[model samples]
Structures are given as C-alpha cells and as structure tokens.
Target: MKMKTRGNFQLQRVIGYFHGTIILFSIIIGAGIFLAPKGVLKYSSLNVGVSLSIWAACAVVSMVAALSHAELGTTFPRSGAQYYFLKRSLGPLISFSYIWVNLFASPAGTAARSLLLAGYIIHPFYPGCSVPEMPKKCLALAIVWCLGILNARGVKEVTWFQTLSTVVKMAVLCFISLTGIVLLVRGRKENLARFEKAFDAEVPDASQIAEAFLQGLYAYSGWGVLVRIAGELKNPGENIPKCVITALTLVALIYLLVNISYLAVLTPKEIMSSDAVAVTWMDKVIPSMQWAISIGVSSSIFSSLNCTVFSSSRVLYVASQEGQLPLILSTLNVHSCPVVAVLQMTILASFIIIPSDLILLVNYVGFIDWLQLGLMMTGLLKLRFQEPDLPRPYKNLWQLILVLLAGRLLRDTFLHYATVSLYVDPLKKILSNICIRNACVSRQFI
Candidate 1:
C-alpha cells in the first residue's frame, strides 16, 4: 500500500488542481481572519472606512503577489517555492536565510495559532475558570502531534481533512455574512449607519498605516502554501495559476464580507475592545446562537493548524532535497510523507508553545514572514530581467508594480523599526545591566 525511502525519496505527484486549491484555501482562510479585524480597526486610527480600505488593499496586493508566485510555480514546478526562487535568483545566502527564519517562524506561528485554538475550545467550558499555562501548552503540543501524524499517514488523508475543514469554516463565515445582511435588510438602521462616519476621527500617519497594513496582511499570510507543494500538483504550470487566482479572489471576497458583517452588527469601540470579535457579535445578535462562535473559532483554528504543519513540513523536506538541510530530513516513510521533517516541525512548535504566549509569536513570525515575502517578490523581479527566456505560462506587468511597492514598504518599515529601536535599545541595556549588577551584589553579600 505504501513505499518507504531512505534517501532521495520522491514526493508523490497525486495532488490535482482542485486539491491544490483546497490546500491553498485552507492555509489562507485560517483563524487569523476571525481575529484580524480587531487589530486592523484598533491600529488604524479608529476609522471604519480606513480600516476596511486597508483590508481590501492588502487583498489586492496579495493577489499581485499570488500572480507572481503562480508564474514561479509554473516555471520552476518545484517544492520549497520561495527558497528555490531565492536560491536561483538571489543566491544561496538569501535562500538559506529565508529557510533559517522559516525554521523558527513557521512552527512558532503555528504554535501560536494552536494555542489560540485550545483557548477557544476551552473558553466555553470554563467561562470563569482560568486556564493554567502548562495545560494550554500540553494541549497545543497534542494538537500539533495529532496533525503531524495525520499528515504522515498520506497526502490524500490530509487533503480530505483540509477540504472538509475549509468548507466548514466557509459555511460559518457565510452564515455570519448572511445573517448580518438580513439584519440590515430588516431595518437595522443604526448598525448599518455606522459606516457613515467612517472617517470621523483623526487620521493615522504613514507609519501607523503601514503597521495596520502589516496586521491585515498577516491574516492573508498563507497564500504561499501552494508554492511549497508545487511539485505534487498535476500539470502545475497551468493549474497553479488557475488555483492561485480562484482561491485568492474567493478568499478576498469572503474576507470583505466577513468584515462588513462584523461592522454591521458591532460598534467600532465594541470591535476594538473585543478579544473574540465573532463571539462578541454573535452574543449580541442572538444569545442562544453564541455557541456557534466558539465552534466556528475552534474549527477555524484546527484547519489553520493542519495547513501550517503540512506546508511547513514541505518546506523543510524541500530544503533537505536541495542539501540546505540534513539528508535525514529528506527521508520519507511508507506513505511518501516526509516523517522526519514533520517531526522536526512538531518539536519546534512544541517548544514555542511552552514559554512564549500567543501575541509574541504572532508579531515575531508575522514580521519575519512579511520580510521574507518582500524578499521573495524582489527575487521574482530579478528572475524576470535576468532570465528573460524562461518559459512562464503566465506573466504580468503588475508583478513589477508589486515588487516596487514591496521594496518601498520594506524600506520604510526597516527605518521605522530602526529609529524606534535606537531609543529603546539603550533603555533595555541599562535595565539588563542593572539586573546583573543586583545579582552580583547579592552574591557578594552572601
């Protein structure tokens, strides 16, 4: 029923365009959408219009990035999509650095989402009871291992689960969207009228706007998952572009609708204060329908966790194929799955869950991911000029615009962080030195 390999194992080429699309959709439509709206509104100078505008704009930018990636997928038709692109266009150093960060960021980010999933699952049961840190960490680790085992079983199994999970999440979102629309149709004037004063507050400057963009973009982070599994896709050159466009367009429309649904039911202030925005809105809509929020959130998180682990393991497996990682990581078990790579991913994610909380991982992984993404877009541009004769089934002039915009935004982000760190670094160092001095003084007294 299965074949195992010790070295240079070949990945099974069983994933078709539809399954490929499902995998990509699973990665992109995870729990982040459920959580990102609040962050967008909170960081976006409290303007409903500006916040929604940023969401829609990020979706457009994501589509551009997707098209560029689709071209790469068609041309290269390999796994480790970003790493391979970087290696070929930029060189080994850049490629290695991207994976190096991926080693930490991917798993840690998954762990953060896993933790959130556990929190949502447990929240209803223990409304007043506080969840201990160790239990949460253990639950997160369990979830990671379970998904890892499922992935190791077979690609078909994973894709089946992924497809089902994605459908459930989509249904939940559609329900919310439809319910909100019905409320507005039934003369819910106050809720629908909230958009009238979308720009009533002070405007956020460019830096703040960039930060808000990053926040919304983080929710849309999984667009690259398909590229990681390109080798498995049947007729990748034609199929990848088709899947990219279809999945991204649908996801963007769904995200826009979900946000409108939230805004239609909740005030801006209420949205900002909400830790669980979906749950908060559901409680207001129909107190009895409140449990749907928890179920929906848990389902979303589970699907996100599955896709993250699946995609991240593929990256490590591909890295091993290129000799950027140990040969052991490239080994596959009886099911044609890279079991070792999955184990490594699980271990790293497990470690991340123990000490750090959710927000730290979110911010840390989101930064590294965006940084690598900007670099990947840059590599796409380099490939266009340097290898003009390469056969790309699809190419677009808009890809160039994406590169230019990404470069400018990255430059601005770097400068903003560097400027802030300059003042903060000294304070951090002083505090560190003072704590060390106190420890040494206590030792001397003893």
Candidate 2:
C-alpha cells in the first residue's frame, strides 16, 4: 500500500474556538429535534417522564462518546477523524472499512435528513397533499448543490454561516421552551399535570424501551462532526476538546427543554399522534407562528446539511491524502477547498434522495453508524495502552462507562430485532448492499 506523503496537500488552519463550537452545535441540533419527540413518546408508552429520562440517558451516552473523541482528536487532530484514529490503533483494514462504509452512508444520511426538510417545507403549503417522490428528490438536489458550492468556496465562509445558523436555531428552541413555561404559569393545568401520571400506567417491554433509546440517540447523532475537520481549526489540540464538550452539553440541554416544551403544549397522546411536534406546539400557542416555525426548522436542517457536506468532504480529502483513496479526490481548488470530494459527496447524496422512505433511511443507517462508533471507541481504548507516552489534552475518564453503554446498546438492539423476523431479514439485505457498494469503490483504487 502507498503511504501518505504530507507534501501532497496543504490545509489552512483558520477556524477558531468559537467558530468550532458553533459548527458542532449546528450539526447536532438538526431536524431531528423538530420530528423525533413523537417517537420517544410512542416508544416509551406515552409516559412524559420516562420519555424525558430516556432523552437524558441518551445524552449521557453521547457525551461519553464525545469525551472519547475529544481525547483522540486532540492527540491526533487530523481530518480523517475516526479513520485516522482507527488506523493508528487497529490497522489499515479497519480504517479502510470505515472509509468505505462512510463513503455512501454519510451522504445517504444527509439525503435522508434533507428529504425530511423538504417534507416539512411542503407540508405547510400543501397540508394533506401527498408530495410525489420526484419533487422531494428535486428539492433535496437543490439543497445538496447549494451547500456543496458554499463549502467549496472556503472554510471561513462555512464557519460564518454555521455560527449564524446555530444562533438562530438555539433562539427558536429557547423561545419554545420559555413559552411552555409561561403557559404552565398561566394555569395551563392539563399539560403540566400529565407529569403526575407519567408512570401511572403499565410500562412497555424492555425491547420497546431500547428501541426508543435508539431513536433518541439518532437525534443526538452529529456530535462528532467537529473532530472530522480538526485540521482546519486554530489551536486544534485545545479547541477540539473545548468544542466537543461545550457543544454536547448545550445540545443535550436544548433537546431536553424542547421535549419538555412539546409535552407542555400537547398531551402525550397528542404528541404521539401529531406529525410535526414543533409546528403543532406553535399552532396550539399561536396559529400565526406556523410559517415562522417552519422557517426555523428548515433553517436548522439547512445548517446541518451544510456542515455534513463540509465534514464529509474533509474526510474524503483526508482518505485520499492518506493513500487510502484515489489521489484525485485530494486535489484542492484555488479556494483551498476539496472540490472533487465535494462533488463526489453531492452526487452520492443525490442518488440516495431519489428512492427511499424517511423511516427506512433512518433505520437502515442506524446499525452501521453505531457499530462504527463502537469500533472507533474500542480503538481509542487500545491506543491508551499502546501509546502510553502520547500527549492528550483531554482524558477519556468515562471509558468504562462508555463500554457498558455500548454493550447494552448492541445487546438490546440484537434482542429487539431477534424476535422480529422482519427486521432480521433486512439486516442481511443492508449488509449485502453495503458490501456491494464497498467493492465498487475499492475497484477504483485498484
């Protein structure tokens, strides 16, 4: 195998601490917050308290994973992110698989979320109308291209947009949370009182609760995007851990309050039945806020799509730089951006948007996403022992806790799907498809 030569590409380190924090925040607080509360409520059997607890638990798990990344990121501080970490600790084979799966899975995830954004944008205009696949795909295409071009221009430009979008998204979520509190203070007894019966009913099976936890984790999925582009940041060793920790804490708090706000306006049953939780809350509070909320949600998803493009392209560039991918993808244009990698990601995402249901898209990527996460975290642990002298700005204090959490997550995932032959059958199909895709990409390098 060819070894990476540092002389091939020069990366600019222009991103500062505050901008780095905003990038992480923008990616974590995407459309999931607007749409995922219902699944948490449904899976937790309509219990407001339990649902909130699950959200908190998932946040803790996410935090542990972020802590692990902080240590690995600060020590290595490279663009390949997980791939770099895995390569150093495990071997090239594992690193190769990480890039191969990510090549398709990352962009497919972006397409899925963009499709979700399109649905919300169109829903308010055509309330009950069924949007055909083509229009949604077209809208998804537009978003991918717009963001792809924006990212190709420069890293500083992307950081400014991310900062502004993060501010707007946080303000909207905080407004909703504060509005819920105000309604409760004004003697909105019904919404607040539901907490009284949070545990009054029979609980769901363990399998169902596990599934709900998985959904909550999906909402917290983008916590690690910052480290992927660590090479572009100023003072990366200090900034990386700072950004990861601050962003994870802020996102978890925002998510918790948002879910609380939803429950405050709509009953658990109402929340479960509603299609869009945030919009529904706004409609209940002030019907005129519908358009405003839709804009906020769309803006939220747009920022996430932009960040996804930015980080994924960087990963591609890093892979190519390391000689794991074709060198053509490592080429940069005059703007100091990976032009070819950006184009490659945009094309893959467009293909993903063309034919897939939102729910299936979400589930299809969940197992692989978590599995990769587990392997990466495991690699981090091994490196701690393997490289005792390696400098680390942040220590992964919760390594043991993360291991137990991942164990439970994987164990429950298997148990839940084992009983359902339907879910089990699809696992094989998805793996086969991933292998086929991986093979096709590998042949290009050969």
Q: Write candidate 2's Cα lDDT for 1-446 as tens digits.
A: 13224466477888888888888889878967876687677788887778989999989988878877677678877776677888889998788888888888888889888888887677677554555666777887888889888988878788888888877877788899888778767776687687666787558778778777777888888877877887888887888888887888988988888887788788888776666677778888998778888888888999988988898888889888788888889888767888889999998898778755555466546656787777877887788889888888777567666667667777877644445634556854576677778677675664
Question: What lDDT is reached at residue 357 by model 2?
Answer: 58
lDDT to native, each model: 0.78, 0.79
Clash pairs of candidate 2? none
The estimated TM-scores of all candidates read 0.89, 0.92
> For model 2, where is the 10-residue window of minimal lDDT?
1-10
Error of 2 at 226 (Å): 2.0
